[model samples]
Target: MCLQIRDIKSKVIYCSAVLLAVMLGLGTRAYGDQLPHFVSVHFGDAIWAGMIYLAFRVLLTRHPLWLSLVLSLCFSFGIEFSQLYQADWIIHVRSTTAGGLVLGQGFLWIDLVRYTAGILFCYVIDQILQY
Candidate 1:
């Protein structure tokens, strides 16, 4: 049976994890050039998705784990799919540093795989740690 968590302790931990994920994500992007080609090209999106999963933990602290996992995938995938629409305004947004980081410039099939792996990896770790 799935159970909701609504405790202060859990909230604090999840919040910390979210922050850590964000820092790591930014750091990865910042140092991408220094890393290997594959890691730089790939790990950024994976880390971003992992950050999303951690953010979901913070946002859905009262929801079941499965709910968070499903929602995170939907949110990540939705953002990726949204890239398909290239209205000028959205394209302009994508040209900026923050917008490009958040919305991404283009879509890649491998990104879907990276996102899935990142979220699932986080979910599995969360389950093991939370229990």
Candidate 2:
């Protein structure tokens, strides 16, 4: 019975991660073309933050919400800061579509704000669902 519960929780977490990924993909594709410039840019960052949070949840299922949020923020900020470095290999990787999405093309202070907003949004949603 204990093992069954753990299995169910794992499946639920995996499903939630998949749902978040779908939302992130849709937001990424819709941005710039279907959405306004400002909304697309900031919202995309928010979704990226949310994805980071979901990733933490998927990997560390036993972690507390606060820990997950902090780790996610740290990771998102780290990626954003990494964009400031322009090494040849990193630049080559960032040139690719996958790398562009993961590493980003350039650094922006506004992205930090967007990431905070996104993580906060996820936290609120998590709290709501808990009730």
Give the number of the best model, judged by lDDT.
Answer: 1
**Each prediction's whole-model lDDT (CA):** 0.86, 0.81
Q: Please write out the lDDT profile of model 2 over residues 31-85, one tens digit for every residue.
A: 6677777776678878778878877777766667788889999999999999999
Q: Total clashing residue pairs per candidate?
A: 0, 0
Model 1 clash pairs?
none
lDDT of 2: 0.81
Clashes of 2: 0
Per-residue lDDT for 18-122 in model 1, tens only?
Answer: 788788778778898888888888887888898888888887787889888998899999989999999999999999999998899898888899999889989
Q: Candidate 1: misplaced stretches above 4 Å?
A: 1-6
